[model samples]
Target: MGIRLPFMVLHAKQILKSTSQNVHNRNKYNVPKGHVAVYVGELQKKRFVVPISYLNHPSFLDLLNHTQEEFGFNHSMGALTILCKEDAFITLTSQLSAS
Candidate 1:
């Protein structure tokens, strides 16, 4: 019975470590399956996970076009960053949702 103490302790530690990793990974990309993550905001970039369907929206496509025309195809910044005010982005998405 005394010999099982160390094994139980090690098992507990492994569980804790694995749980921590899972949490970190989940938060690292809150974007769910079938959705895409986009970075927006001007002064401070913020990440937003949006549906792939947004690509078909003309207004959204226009933004992508402008970004391409200005920044070129290579964002190289890890995530696609949309240059715009946070408030404006919120309004646009809200309107999109309404439509």
Candidate 2:
């Protein structure tokens, strides 16, 4: 059996908060420039519009560095990569698990 880490939930919450704040701040400044906006669904659910340009933004870099220090190098790298390539990673993981 695989051992699950207890701090996973806490780490997840921290990451979510960090990412959400990054998105929020980006929207505040970038929206006026027509660089970013929120994705609102018919049901009123909202998702952040994260552009590739935001990857090098100061706030994003700060969050990335903070997350790396908190989560350690490898885990943080994997998490970031997954976020960058979500659909492909999900498909690969699902295929591997089905075998």
Candidate 3:
């Protein structure tokens, strides 16, 4: 348990450093801590600020995989653009929140 502390601290420091680098962007969007802005939709993309914790869930990971396969990470929106309908994304997130 004690041995893991230093690695966790270092990892946290790295995250803080990267977050500091994006401070300007975060401020521009007013994104709250522990949340991330993602664009979801096919024809007309819509932005949604979702809990960062959702990334760890299998259902969310599946959506991410679909985005990766479709867009290859070079999103023109400059943010994560999920490849799914707006209603579908809403349903998935709602389900995640329920569970």
Candidate 4:
């Protein structure tokens, strides 16, 4: 498990790099596209996957800004269920406790 964790981290790093490059290239060419990049084992819950362009999207950015203003930090994958408005607090609390 320990060795696998390192390998997963390395693979996730490579995936993130590739995704960033792809986003950069698409932006340079003015392409209307987005990429879902996954970081496996980056957190304890298996993987962290999100749209690369979503980070810059107006709605998501607004939410992120609001979260930062309210919580003093950006929402993280580990804290998504905790911070997201749609998530049920009771369920999330139980899940978190189990973990």
Highest lDDT: which candidate? 3
Give model 3 RMSD, 1 decimal: 7.1
Candidate 3 per-residue lDDT, tens place, 1-99, comes to 344334433433454355447878767777678776778888888889888788767777777766665665555666667778899999999999999
**CA shift of 30, model 4, Å:** 28
A best-first ranking of the candidates according to their TM-score comes to: 3, 1, 4, 2
Candidate 4, residue 55: CA error in Å? 0.6
Each model's C-alpha lDDT? Answer: 0.60, 0.38, 0.70, 0.39
**Candidate 1 off by > 4 Å:** 1-27
Against the hidden reference, what TM-scores do the models get? 0.64, 0.28, 0.74, 0.33
For candidate 2, give the lDDT of residue 5. 31
Assess the local accuracy of residue 10 in candidate 3 as a C-alpha lDDT between 0 and 100: 48
Backbone N/Cα/C clashes per model: 0, 0, 0, 0
Quality of model 2 by C-alpha lDDT = 0.38
Query: Candidate 2 on 7-97: residue-level lDDT in tens?
Result: 3334444544454467655564343432233232223324443444443444444444444455443442212322223343344335534
TM-score of 2: 0.28
- lDDT at residue 9 of model 2 (Cα atoms): 31
The lDDT-based order of candidates, best leading, equals 3, 1, 4, 2
lDDT of 1 by residue, 1-99 (tens): 334333433432343344345666468766566556667876688887677666556676666666555664334435556777778778877878799
